[model samples]
Target chain A: MARELTHGASADSVGTRPRVAAQPFLRRNVPILALIGLLVVSGVYFSLASDTFLTLGNFLNIVRQSAPALILAVSMTMVMTTRGIDLSVGSLTAMVGGVGAVLMRDGWSVWAAIVVMCAIGVVAGSVNGFFVAYQGIPAFIVTLAGFTAFRGIALILTEGFSIPMRDERFVWLGQGTIRNVPVPVVIALVFGIIGWLVFNKTPFGMRLVAVGSNPEATRRSGVNTAALLLRVYVISGLAAAVAAIVIAARLGAGSSNAGLGLELEVITGVVLGGTSLFGGIGTMTGSLLGVFLIAMIANGLILLRLDPFYVPVVQGRFSWARCGCTPMWRVSATLRRDSF
Target chain B: MVTPEEHEDGGSVPGLDTPEPDDFVLQASDLTKSFGSVAALRGATLELRAGEVLGVVGDNGAGKSTLIKTLSGVVAPDRGTIFFAGELVHFSSPRAARSLGIETVYQDLALCEHLTVARNLYLGRELTRHGLPWLDDRRMARSAEQFLERLGIVAVPGDAVVRNLSGGQRQAVAVAKAVAFSPRVLILDEPTAALGVREVEQVLDLVRRVRADGVGVILITHRMQDLFEVCDRLLIMYEGTDIARLTTKNTTLEEIVYYIDGGSGREHQRAGSITSAS
Candidate 1:
């Protein structure tokens, strides 16, 4: 909003402003710009570390692998935008993936299994929404419960066994290429487009940001804030469920633990991309960049002959870097606020 | 939809008071509300006239908030009637009140600072293209620009975020938002409470301007100076009811203080019921 610092019209004293000055571009869009910079820096760093990292094949490989996570990250951005978190997404993916696999293995049609999986996702999201919205339970508590209980449901459904998916078409949906681009990647792109449009252009998008920005004010504006909040969770659950199908099909198996720590990964991408942990500030493009950045870092380290464990070590650090980003953003945002 | 001209021709209901100096836009009579044992509004009555700025002044907790909340339908008066444009209306909610051209601007609750000025202007009521969810952003920006222009607020750009606005500009945007709906009755609660000198002057001028546009403005404030500046009539509240109703032109600041400090006037028996001022 205050994109031009030099032309800033602080003009007078009114409400208290942060007593610091910052470049307007960096002040307003630190997350997106920082993520882009991070992406380039990491790309260059990785390419130098491993000769094959800069190759087009390896880059697409990262895209193909990060599709499910990227897709889910889109939904997490929506959830996090409303200052709500869906911790159960990982468990949700596990349950849906396991169920879809179990259904496909039992000779059910792939299309029918997909429909059933969507229904499961809706119900799961609705449950989380109801407890968080209608029942007045804090989202952190309810989703935290989902994080624990939904995985248990998945474990019970699969009996801790992995189901093999043999459907050729189903596998192709995840693994096949369309015009030399992976299908999951294409699907992720579609989700990203729709998510971006919804967050930027639609009235629903404005309301979502308003709800996150100031719930009391939005409610007083005569909006059905509770309904919007509930719908956001439903969207997150639906995304996770769909991503589950992709994950299962891509691996040719649906395990009860298909997406262990996946919630963390999606959140890492969303937060690392500069989406404010303090709600009301997020970007779909930022999350997309963040997903690729994480994917590249993980891929690059593995290609560099580092232990596979180093990926998580790096990922954990990247995610926690969000906490650091918060303070940085605060200082800079305050600085920007005062600049004009 | 009734025009100001049609209202002046006596739209069926004649003014209850003589001289007809006040053509009531909205009249709240004997409104009462209670929270548990505490009575917030005890038969509080006030009238807002078309093209007039009626200021309601009282110390904190004198049921000023409750009275306006009841009139604006944020609170359901346990006993009262709110007549809007001579039509008896039941404001079941604030939305219902707004639907009947009654708008309330609460302190700092009107604008979402994170949103753009155009977005804030059309927050709850955004225009859509092709009747779809796609917001008509350009249309909104154009209209918001025109709306601010009409209000004579030039400092704020339509694209600027409310967060970047000066306190005065933000207040203007909030008022502009309410004005965009072409409301018949606008209620401003402590409009100048947190503003600086110049910003407060801007808001006071805005009140005068909004009143000139035939919108009956109910200005709830405690600033005596502000009451003198833009208000047409001053309604002073003591305890839970109206203590004095004085026309701003004929009344002095000293008399307002007398009623504010609880003096026994024409309604002596009722006014004398409260022995202590505070």
Candidate 2:
């Protein structure tokens, strides 16, 4: 019987080899599968609902519209993976765009203005990182303070009005397309690829996950967890700055309300992508799909001739529905209940 | 019946060459620890030699865990001198202790169950590819496979998540992770407490394999059968003090039990008289 068991085991092992091989494949592909399924169902529903829904022009329009939120979603994923939230991303975007527009208006070259804008974003993010990571403040509270204070700063810079950049070079980056793809889309793709490599291929990526999984374990493992947490906030800041630049160029003006409520959108994208809000489990691809899913849902809803006011309710309901399904939300809820 | 003095000098008196004292790889002298006014450990001392299994048996709150924590640097002793490989050192933290090749396999296993067996093995100190600071997943998995095989731990897939492994396998992985550090001293807390007979045997075999590699092991348990089966020297702690130190070969279970249960003797009489008077 032992010999037969061994023989049977080997036979089953060889026969069911794909089962073992598919383990990680299954784990990593669940979000992707869900993404594809959602897209297919939505595409069919929207196509059947409206004659103009499936057109290439409308699809391109959706890409153009979702480009900014998608870029911000990438940054949000990095911060969220480390179990952090950046509510100030929207304000940081407005601050960067407002400051950059004012700088360009004041005789600064387009490239120099872009650099300054991104620097401003990094500084804003670093401040948030410093207060949260070093000062040991809750991210929600720190970013909430940033949400109000940074927007006030943006309003002060723009004098509570829109600032326009007339420079053609600056406008081209926001509005131009290379090889028929919008510059913002290309930029978002670039950020996505970079984010993917950083989160998966580097020691920093491993440490980020480690810190998110269990900070004490990471600290005991001789990793400087504080520095890692700081770096994620910085990345989120840079991403917000980049998104701000794109939004400003596309609008041809920077307003205090330019990137308003973006925190909700980027967070929605990340949560929908299956990146746990609780920290430790997420992927760049998942976040990307999440952004697209949100974009598609919005676009499909519009094509279906739905009331714009009802759109948020539908999307908000969907988000709440997903709260119970995702592992990250469940884990965070459990941690909160247990710790409290 | 051999007297205590005869037992101490038996190896040298006629037949046995007393084991050299210098063989000890790690030793603690007059270890004392207290949390505020409550004394957790008092004048506790133990020694572990190269390639030897020393079992520490004690009841709950008897300070066996406290002593292990002190040695592993999870807690600092108020007064004690720790000599590791003949060098006096003080470990301020568990990381410092681990850097000096002293690893503690905690009861919780201290493992991230969400990670794979290979990842758990190389959780802290991962193998990185040359010229790049990225983790070399292939190399780590291969090394984990080799280590598990050396410890005779079978049926565990290299990429299998630790949560999927049985309690015995998890313990094996935890031990493997500690041994991978190449620590001169390995402290295990109740390694086989929750295992079945077959699993217990597997863990014991792994412990023997660890000792064979010349690592001194401190096995903490309450099981007399386990101590008799595996440990060479037995140290029994009762009420925060090492009351009796015996060789497994020279002592019987009844005597050890008597010492463990506070053995109705003069010490008990003095305590009883004082309590009655109070």
Candidate 3:
């Protein structure tokens, strides 16, 4: 079937029918398949190396630790599908958390602080969106400015200090368990499901892919491409804020130093999950696996008594190795088109 | 040679109280636009009757594209008037023109390569379930199939990604997208610019099918032979102004080529103009 598509040399036999034979499930999802294989191999290795690694408690703990990163990664998928990046997310997380912490310490209601955090997220995202969408600035440049500016604001707000939380209920959002599942895990699952639905079943999701694929074409089709791009950045920012709240609750403090270099981790996981860095292609399922893979690797490395520092090194190398395969698929697809 | 006034009267005339003689569906008169120092369209005018295929042929930079852009509302003209079914209208954007039943299939086809055929067909205008935010993919796919079948476009399935389709199939999908809306005025810009011999025939046949549906089609092309094959009348443009309009039944291919080549000299212009106006 692949050969038939690649070579128009046999046009006579195939006739004018351009009906592409449906690719088998495995063939269509090679990246996801590869990730699953890696997971199994790594799971086995970890299970043998550390008896505690395969335990249900350890698995739940991994989910809890990775919940915040997963939340950010899910939104990153949406942004990247529009061929956009949000370097500001890490810093936005810190800023939102720091501000929320300060507001709570000042005797503000938790609901009020949460609302304010979301508002800050919207404002910050709108600014980034305005420059990238309305002002025609590149997203990378706009978000890079946002990254520095937001982190600075967070540091200034918290006075470069960590403020401990006194509200047990607010902290419970992170540390509490519901029906034997950690609250953060449940939240992550909800986010994952919502992200999948929005990415696959909504017009907003389809337009993101279209805008990334061909902005001019989409604009010509009467779509407000600028607004679509703005919404994408806002979603990223909003998700970052939500993640920040979860992190703050877990830490029982709002720290200006939280989520440092977190943007790279989220981006790496999204890319590793088969969402193309170039945009126009994204998979929520793949992202889930990618985030889990990273978190598991980190946990297993610690359990194996390996230097905790090797976690980043292994992650960087593993992502490089996995993402390296992505371009090969893209190249072959390009070659097939060029053959025509 | 056929001046703008020589055709049917389409522009607004206050208190005239005279019904238009020609069944003209769309008309653009004395349209002019300039980008910085370069004038793209200078006094370009044309008329389209319902169920007629009007061929717009020109050399490179002849402003064929610019004139079409103005008519389709892609680019606002700096000066001119457009009449749609005898009502003077202004198009603020392509969406406005589309809402008024004018659909343009640009040279690039405006298809999202990563999306499936059904998805590309309903890119911006999506059908949601009970007007909710969720897409009605099943219904859209079903309707997409019906649309292709109605156009006699075979072999392309709704589920197939656009990137995998051949060039001809992609063109077919673009045309189907325009026609599915049941547009009154269908403008095709260089639809056959990038296609094999068979593919060109398929697109030309599609144009014929659209024309038979009583839609006014303005086809812009550089290929003289294609114009003769599908167009009812030819509007020849040169140096950003339409210089001649000729009926296919009355003019030879040589005559059309002469106008496209600037009619060479003043004598030729006079002769060409006289022939076209007559």
Off by over 4 Å in 2: A1-28, A55-57, A102-113, A123-127, A130-137, A320-340, B1-24, B27-47, B73-83, B86-93, B234-278
Leading candidate by DockQ: 3
Q: Which tens-of-lDDT digit does each residue in A238-334 have in candidate 3?
A: 9888999899999999999989988988887888899887888888888888988999999999999999877889878778778777777767667
TM-score of 2: 0.80
Once fitted onto the true fold, the runs of candidate 3 whose alpha carbons sit more than 4 angstroms away are: A1-18, A331-340, B1-23, B264-278
DockQ of 3: 0.28
Q: Write the residue-wise lDDT of candidate 1 on A1-340 in tens digits.
A: 1011111223332223222221356567866766676678777888888889988888889988888889888888888888888899999999999889888888899899999999999999999998877887888899999999988988998899887898899999888999998888888889889999998899888988887888877766666778888999999889988899889889888888888989988888888886766788878888888888888889999999999977788867766654565677678766655655
Highest lDDT model number: 3
List candidate 1 segments past 4 Å from native: A1-27, A105-107, A319-329, B1-24, B34-38, B75-81, B86-93, B196-202, B264-278
lDDT, candidates in the order shown: 0.78, 0.75, 0.82
Tens-place lDDT per residue, model 1, B1-278, is 22434322212222234434235788888888999999988888888778877889887788888898888777888998888877788976676887777887887656776788878877777778887888888767656665565555435566777776666677777767766676789899987766677778777777766676788988887677787777777788888899888877677766776777676564554344233432
Judge candidate 1 against the unseen true structure and give its global Cα lDDT, from 0 to 1.
Answer: 0.78
Ranking by lDDT: 3, 1, 2
What C-alpha lDDT does candidate 2 achieve relative to the native structure? 0.75
